[model samples]
Target: MRKNSIKNIRINSEVQKELSNIIRTEVKDPRIHPMTSVVAVEVAPDLKSCKAYISVLGNEKAAEDTLEGLKNAVGYIRRALARSVNLRNTPEITFILDQSIEYGVHMTRLIDDVVGKEEVSDDGMNTEGDEGSC
Candidate 1:
């Protein structure tokens, strides 16, 4: 069930912060890129499951390897989480690759290129689409 109560929201917020810290510092997988960061954390109201969104740095191969490494290290992290937090039942953690940041970057570059082309053609310059200017 989704957390509807204020107390549950607070608990989730605290858990997210703690888990973000734990995941950021505790896991030392060589596969993980140095620029990786926790993008989001979602915990069930009952605290049985947690979904972590992580952004990977470098190429696609690096991201895939990092994900595999994170999956393998989940157990160790969960145990550490149980010890660090005062929760009765530690949530099962799952890692997801967060690509929205990369997608946004790609879109931004595309927009910039389009704007640059437009600026270059601003002074009565015509390519294929400008029959009137031609």
Candidate 2:
């Protein structure tokens, strides 16, 4: 199957959803943060391996711990995936720490700071102009 085929896309989304459910409801590792989420999943065309992008809404230490926790539970996770998703081959899931969400939040904060400063400077300039006009 082609990588971007409709079938592959469907499988990817199904796997992503199932993985999220498994992690959220099944896994009981304390190291895994409660704010952890499966952001994305990529199932290879061969269905032999998969990449699960995980996002943790916490500090770096928390993200590391979550990754470690997921790694340790790979076997159980795979079995769950197989049970939940009737795929020909239950892909070996590789949990990858995805920082895209954190990066986006950081960028949003920076943009907001810049915008706030600009607004303040604009107000100051407007006040100065009004005084000069008076």
Candidate 3:
């Protein structure tokens, strides 16, 4: 049952949504940062386990604390999920820090830096060519 079928996709989205809401409204752990967000959710095809990718807007400390908070509240979150969703077996929740967004931003900055340098060199070359012509 490793297929990524339509039903699995739907269940993933539903779990992601419900978890996000539960975290935002129900969970009151101080370690959980206010800027934490559910980036994505991957549910097993058997619906026995789930991995929730979370992103925290602060530094490494915030990310760690948020993850710790989530880990400590896993039982509560699972119960909440069981109550909210109609799944036969509630998936065991695991929170993982997702740095994909931060990595994308860093890559974009590097690309812009390279492009900017190339444009400056091109401009200098054009100026040199014009001077030689004149």
Global Cα RMSD, each model: 4.1, 0.7, 1.5
Ranking by lDDT: 2, 3, 1
Candidate number with the higher TM-score (1 or 3): 3
Q: Write the per-residue lDDT of candidate 1 for residues 1-134, one digit (tens) a residue.
A: 45767766776777667767776788888887777777877778888998888898678999998889889999988888888788868999999999999999999999999998888877455454577656
- What is the C-alpha RMSD, rounded to one decimal, of candidate 2? 0.7
In angstroms, the error of model 1 at 100 is 0.5
Q: For model 3, what is the error of residue 71's alpha carbon versus the real structure, in angstroms, after optimal superposition?
A: 0.4
What's the TM-score of each model vs. the native? 0.82, 0.98, 0.91
| Candidate 3 colliding pairs | none
Q: Please write out the lDDT profile of model 3 over residues 23-112, one tens digit for every residue.
A: 999999999999889999999998988999999988999899999999999999999999999998999998999999888988999999
lDDT of all predictions, in order shown?
Answer: 0.82, 0.97, 0.94
Q: Which candidate is the best by TM-score?
A: 2
Q: Rank the candidates by TM-score, best first.
A: 2, 3, 1
Off by over 4 Å in 3: none
| Model 1 pairs whose backbones collide | none
In model 1, the Cα lDDT at residue 35 comes to: 77
- Model 1 lDDT on a 0 to 1 scale: 0.82
